[model samples]
Target: DVAKGYILYLEDISVSFDGFKAINELNLYIKEGELRCIIGPNGAGKTTMMDIITGKTRPDQGSAWFGQNINLLELSEPEIAQAGIGRKFQKPTVFEQLSVFANLELSMAGEKGVWTTLTATLTGEQRDRIDNVLVKIGLIEHRYQDAGSLSHGQKQWLEIGMLLMQNPKLLLVDEPVAGMTHQEMDRTGELLTSLAGEHSIVLVEHDMDFVRSLAKQVTVLHQGSVLAEGSMAQVQADPRVVEVYLGE
Candidate 1:
């Protein structure tokens, strides 16, 4: 039954701003433990979709669900965050003054207040998790370094490490490799690929090369709804998708 459950699901979702429909009758689903890439042109409603799922924006109509019965539309933003869903925005927002290790430690679940977690000691289990996350994110060597001192790409990796600390069931990542070098992009591809089977991921990215490297199911969004869905090859071959995206 593992494959029968949907980790994230939306039905007839719509969002509008001043009479302009940002997301019009959007319907999408993500399977558990699947890494799905979402690519779209500007105003394609990618951000609006993430916003609705994360509780930042409520839809005008339709239902959003986490798992089977959990209604995403009824929950507040913090409630959604606590319900095992994690999101990483395009820009990295690490604590510049804190060490990489400290940032991850602070991001762990429980007692999330700034001053309280900063002063609390990590239990053995917490330490182990942080250590493992550092390794997984390829930041063990930089664990003690000031997060502000890292390069743009390194900071992105560190932010991802912070997300791992919570052990969320699903992660929504946005444009993770925007400004990285070729080497950094490849490493990021490897990192995201390694996390797929264990964590369901919905990534919004514009980098076709990076998306191709991941080689998973790709979804193309146009005018606020799905225009294409399948392997990258199939999506590229779709004339409608080609005209709106690849052809550009």
Candidate 2:
């Protein structure tokens, strides 16, 4: 049996929009409990690749598989999400009017296909899980505070907390440190680093410093394909990477 140690596998994925190939023969893999970062210049198909993984855009060719048994290309977007793949966009989207606790509660997947008030009766397990996530997100003290009142970083954390409520096996985060203050970025880095061993995380970011702090493996994309992949030091040392970054 194959070890089944990989959380995600993309094999020669290619996507074309209006006859122009945005992603071409992209091959990538993320191991279980690993934190990987994807970096690329503009037009590198970074966003399109993410969309393909999340089922927003179907690839024109190749395969995307989750774990050993699941063929992701056959799943719908919501189905993919339900299969323990969580994605966070560059912008924070939280329930502004809802209190922080309420926001997290609404995100609980165990509640079935319906929306309920935070004060509604919840199973003991559900309540305990929410409480634990609140603590992990560092918002236990502000549980009752309105999410709208939180700082930018706090709102971002709240959104992440919401995603955490679903207990995803893999997290896809895009530009998490963008527009964040240095202090907030450091905290976010710590939070993501802590999540590595528990949840496989793939971070797409342009910030080299942030990637250095978070990535165990880094893949650089250019011209709709992987330009280089390795540790930050290894990729940075590649002449192709240097020429790509500095020559332009």
RMSD (CA, Å), each prediction: 1.9, 1.6
- List ranges where model 1 is wrong by over 4 Å: 1-3, 246-248
- CA error at residue 50 for candidate 2, angstroms: 0.6
Which TM-score value belongs to model 2? 0.95
Q: Write the per-residue lDDT of candidate 2 for residues 121-217, one digit (tens) a residue.
A: 8878887998998888788899999999999998988898999999899999999989999999999998888888899999999889988876579
My TM-score estimates for the predictions, one after another, are: 0.95, 0.95
Would you give me the overall lDDT of model 2? 0.89
Worst 10 residues of 2 by lDDT: 111-120
Report lDDT (Cα) of residue 180, candidate 1: 100
Off by over 4 Å in 2: 1-3, 111-119
Candidate 1, lDDT over the whole model: 0.91
